[model samples]
Target: MEQSQIQNHNLEKKRRRVLNKPLRLRCSVQNYNWGILGNKSHVARLFSLNSGSHIDPDESYAELWIGTHESGPSFVDDQFDCLNSLKEWISKNPDVLGDQVLKKWGGELPFLFKVLSIKKALSIQAHPDKELARALHKSQPSLYKDDNHKPELALALTEFEALCGFISLKNWLGGADAEQWLPVNEMDKNHELEAVLESIFSQILLSSKDKICQSLSKLKWRLNLEKKKRQLTDKEKLVLRLEGQYPADAGVIAAFLLNYVKLNRGEALCIGANEPHAYIYGECIECMATSDNVVRAGLTSKHRDIQTLLSMLKRRQGFPEILQGLSLNQYTTRYLPPFEEFEVDRCILPEAASVVFPSVPGPSLLLFISGNGTIGASVPEEQMVEEGDILFLPAYMEFTITSESKELHLYRAGVNSSFFQAY
Candidate 1:
């Protein structure tokens, strides 16, 4: 068979398999361990919109997952259609998985996408790298859970704040109150980051309860004193906030060791494996490699794996880069991260504009953030989507989105060759 004939035959097979249309998948909600309490969260509102009902007033809203990762695989209908079933169908019709993704990931959707609503601070935590993840899962299945590495991208939907990575060495050691850290100042500059961090963190965690209380009181007094004189640094403000929320818990001091990051709407931060972080407030869309293993340090009532967490720290310290979307065209901004597991694009359509996306080589998950829109491969075949709605686009499926309101906002998540080209 000639190349053109092979291509035409493949196209026919794909049309029969996927029909060039988007499928409205029912995403599942997760309350998880740490999340904003009550119905005040945007997550709750979004959930209500998607399910066509109100969320319980007392239940905390956390995450709405739109993938097939076993933890919270999305369904296709009331029959509880699973993504695994979709995978099975794609296996027989390889064109629906596309040659690139099928060849690389064995037809698996390699990312987990989420919308997070945080009303309070999450635990101080870090995710293990791929190799560490596998070993930990094998040794401690209950705690480690999965064997995949989780390198995540957090894009702010509303004003957001988080503790990400470590502060620069100069800032960590040369601050005005540098003397307070004692041995941190005394340690050799040539020591390994693991040794340096382990030494300091161990001291903080091992401090007596009375010492912790005393330190907390002293920090409050100094902050109040500084308030009368000058503005507090970002780190100072974060320390004060954590102390207020956690009282004398050692995590209050841990906050000082990490960089405090504040992201305005549309800004983002890519969290690499072994980087310590915590979401402080507001809502964001997060994407990660399909893993749930986390080693937490503090600031919560949950179990703290101090030794494991300390061991996992990257040891290399620096500020994390905040990302801005690269405009793909007039209607979309692609927020490309350095990792390959996933990339997100924000599509902003004006009142009457319509955008056509040609068939992509990998599957995509779309989430409706605001406004109303109609999605279809052909005008006659479409579905109406409003806030909180989710659609799964199989590979080789071309579709168009038309805004039905004054403005329509949505996010698209997928993985591609771009993932391997960058960090």
Candidate 2:
């Protein structure tokens, strides 16, 4: 080979060696006020496991973030070569995101993967769509930090409760499964119902403080009487629980406006753009577009953006669909939403067994939910991974893992397969 050609070939060979290797990432933990307390928190436990540091019994650990988001950026584990941050690493090696992903997101990770330990009701809020997100960011950069839409999915790690979307008033109010909330006039039945929901939701947000207080008091009194006659329903109980957290707060009333859904382990909920939702309690795996934009109406001491949130919210009402995984292989199940940003795969390996994940279109983030195992591109150079461990897998790199426990469970977050198929 010619001298210059040989040098180019050698450089390209070195690049491949660095790009395909799995990198252990020390992810960031968020200590938000509403998080689980001390050693009881999964976030805290995972942080402790990652750093070999003692978990404080009193601190609130809300989230363990495993991505390149600016709010909770991860870093390359020190056992390997030291790196500044996950974001920095991605910027330096843009091809690690894959050609399609790199071109779409400009050297950024499109999805932010998280583990949330919710002890209280989160803010009653909605995420704007892409166009509105851009407008919101341009108008109020301090509040809406990014110009990206956040369509998130949550997979239950335990028993999880959340208020998602609006409830079907026709069924809940009129007790008519196939009837309308209001008498059908000239308009379409669905559109008519949507208008009613929109009107009621608007009134709820626009209610005056004194009016809110009186409504809350009357509702409490009625609930007390109802409880004397019979046990309160779960939705009714949720209202009382939230009242203790934020006395007479607007979010307490939100229970009536939104659908109360409970998810058992392995089930998932997809929160699309403009859908109103709040995580009530329990631990879950959350993945979304990389953005920190939230338009909160209540249940927070922070500023409320009622008008903005109202403008962006969907008025349709019905029970949202619960997602179950489809088997991808003998050891893996995948959950894919109708979105282009991301998808997740759950992998389970029996004790003393092994499986190889086929090469995927883009880089992915993996979290070991339980069990200890060895993972790598190949066996001899494998690294040990236990519960709470996080690893970054590069694009087009086939990965192999072997379980050392009774059963191993882990979730992998990656770009949508459709993105690659299009290319």
Candidate 3:
């Protein structure tokens, strides 16, 4: 081989060495607040936790992270000590991440993949956009670590409930006295929706505990009395549930003002920067830009950053439009969002049928949500994957997935290209 040809040959060998096989990943589970209590969580079951597993019966299983986000980076196969060192390992192998990602994001992973199991509602929160995130991180590095935006997309694993964005409070406001319910200040009486919302939140935060309790008690009595006259709506039931979980919580009161959404299995909801939302309950497969920075308003024992949250929120009216995945074929459906950082797709490989995934600009994280199957690359190497298993595929590495069981369902998360191009 000539000099350039010899160099190309060596590069081809390195690519084959690294990208020819799928690397089974061991992800880290996060036992955070607001998670489902006990091992009854789908996350726990998916991870195969039994009576012998060293898990507290009362501990909440919050999230199972399957990416290189530093908080809970998944490990490469057989690299037990590299549990949180996958990002560092990828730094050494730039080819695995591909040139586009390396050029755009350096050695860092651009997205974070998660399996979230929420029992109690999460805080009423919104993440900052890229510009704001950069400023926030610059000013408060202790709270916001990364200078990147966090736009999230979540697909339901179970019947999922959430409070997302503002709905027109006009109808609700007309029936009741906004002044009595929200205790808005005089200056905010004629303010825009944004300022009015801020005032309402501020009042809720500043009100005496006894006053909040009294208000909640009256509201509960009214709902009960109304129920006797007629059937309660879904929104009313949601309010009751929120009250049951966190009585007199500002978030419960705030929840009454937001859009209530229910996502069935395979349905998705996208929340962009500054779109306030609270995951109420259920299991979900969530993907987001690589950041954990959240500004919260209420509904938790965690730190409440009301000022920061108010500043970051969009302060608009109406529920967000839920995203529906468009099928590429019988087996594959792509969930294309507007953001450039990440795209997610679902594949259901049927028994005796297979689907080939072509190359992409960046590496991919494949999560086996259910069923059993075998996956192989161009090189003929194959491995079995079952429920809860995760595999990392290097950039430009083509692969085929086939089902040995009845069907195998998998979700793939990667940096967007073609799908985004059309959108």
Candidate 4:
């Protein structure tokens, strides 16, 4: 063969080597302070079960990462070069990323898949859009890791609650919340909706630490009273809960400003880039772009970019759209957000049942949340799969899963098919 043809042959061989089999993976675990402690954390339970590693009962188990993101990369269990992370594997065989993703994001994966077991509220934060992310990364490389924007979807694994976007103008300045949000009404007596919100939020952002502590004490005292406790709205109750977790923090009081969203199991909410939101409580499956850049304002001791967060936030009011997922088959329901970065699917198979996942144009990660099954790939090979297991499937690979004793629940993470349609 000629030199050019020889290079093509070798590249094709590398692609076939990676695409022919499923990779059983061991993912990284993050222990954030806001996570559930010990065995109570779903992240811990799954990580220990999957890796056979010791679980620290006193330590918090926060996030189980299942991707090639540098923050917490996954490792292949069955491969001989087990020391190399999935990130390294992808670098060797970039063709595994598929044409659409490889063309757009180069050698890196475009999305990060995670299981978050939250026991307390995460930082009241917002992610920047592409333009702002690029600027921030250029100016502050240490703080902002990547130029990629982080637009995430939070799917409730259990009953999940969060502070998302701003509440309606009427809700903030009238009715049951009028007394609690008295300052907002006082600050913006003459301004329109967005102006009123800006003035209120700006004041909160600029408040003295002493004043915030004092306000939190007063709010708690009032809510603890017999009369107020009985009539506490969902937002008010969340305020009290957040105050309990983060005493004297402004985010506790921010409950009155942001919409309190309650998502039941299997429901999802997508927070676009530059939207101000926080995960308040409960367990969830979170998927987003592979970047770890977050601009925080309050609710934690993390670094704050108050000015950047304030400037980037979208002031739109009203609750976020709740996605119940579209049913693709008897066993699968897909929660594909409007963002092109990610598409998540929930699959449940009853005892002695099977489900076929068609070939995809991009790489994918399959998380077995519960039960046991056997996964059959192309040809006559079968692999045993169990609860807490994670499998990485390369591009253009199809597989069928059959549940054994009980119902099998799993989450499949993939890129949106629209990216490949052009190719």
lDDT of each: 0.78, 0.84, 0.79, 0.86
Per candidate, the number of residue pairs that clash is 1, 0, 0, 0
Q: Candidate 2's residue-wise lDDT over 3-119, tens digit each? A: 999998987776566666787888888988999998888788888887677888888899999998888899987433466688887887888888889888888999999999999
> What is the descending TM-score order?
4, 2, 3, 1
lDDT, candidate 4, 115-166, per-residue tens: 9999989999999999999999999999999898999999999999888898
**Clashes in model 4: which pairs?**
none
**RMSD from true fold, candidate 2:** 4.4
Candidate 3: which stretches are off by over 4 Å?
A: 1-16, 49-56, 79-84, 169-189, 192-199, 418-423
lDDT of 3 by residue, 1-423 (tens): 699999989877764565567777777888887788766786766655211246567888899888888678777764322443667667766678888788778888888988899988888889999898999899988888888899989999899999888766675576432444455567776887556765676677657778878878887888888889988878778878988988877777777777889999888999999988999999998999999888877887777778777777786777687877988789998887777788888898878788888977688999897788888886766877788788888888889888988889889999977633453
lDDT per residue, candidate 1, 286-311, as tens digits? 99888888888788888888888887
User: Candidate 4 — which residues are off by over 4 angstroms?
Assistant: 1-18, 185-187, 226-230
Question: Candidate 1: TM-score?
Answer: 0.87
Q: Which of the two candidates, 1 or 4, achieves a greater TM-score against the reference? A: 4
1 or 3: which has the higher lDDT?
3
The TM-score of candidate 3 is 0.88
Question: Largest TM-score belongs to which candidate?
Answer: 4
In model 3, what is the error at residue 32, expressed in angstroms? 2.1
For model 3, the local distance difference test gives: 0.79
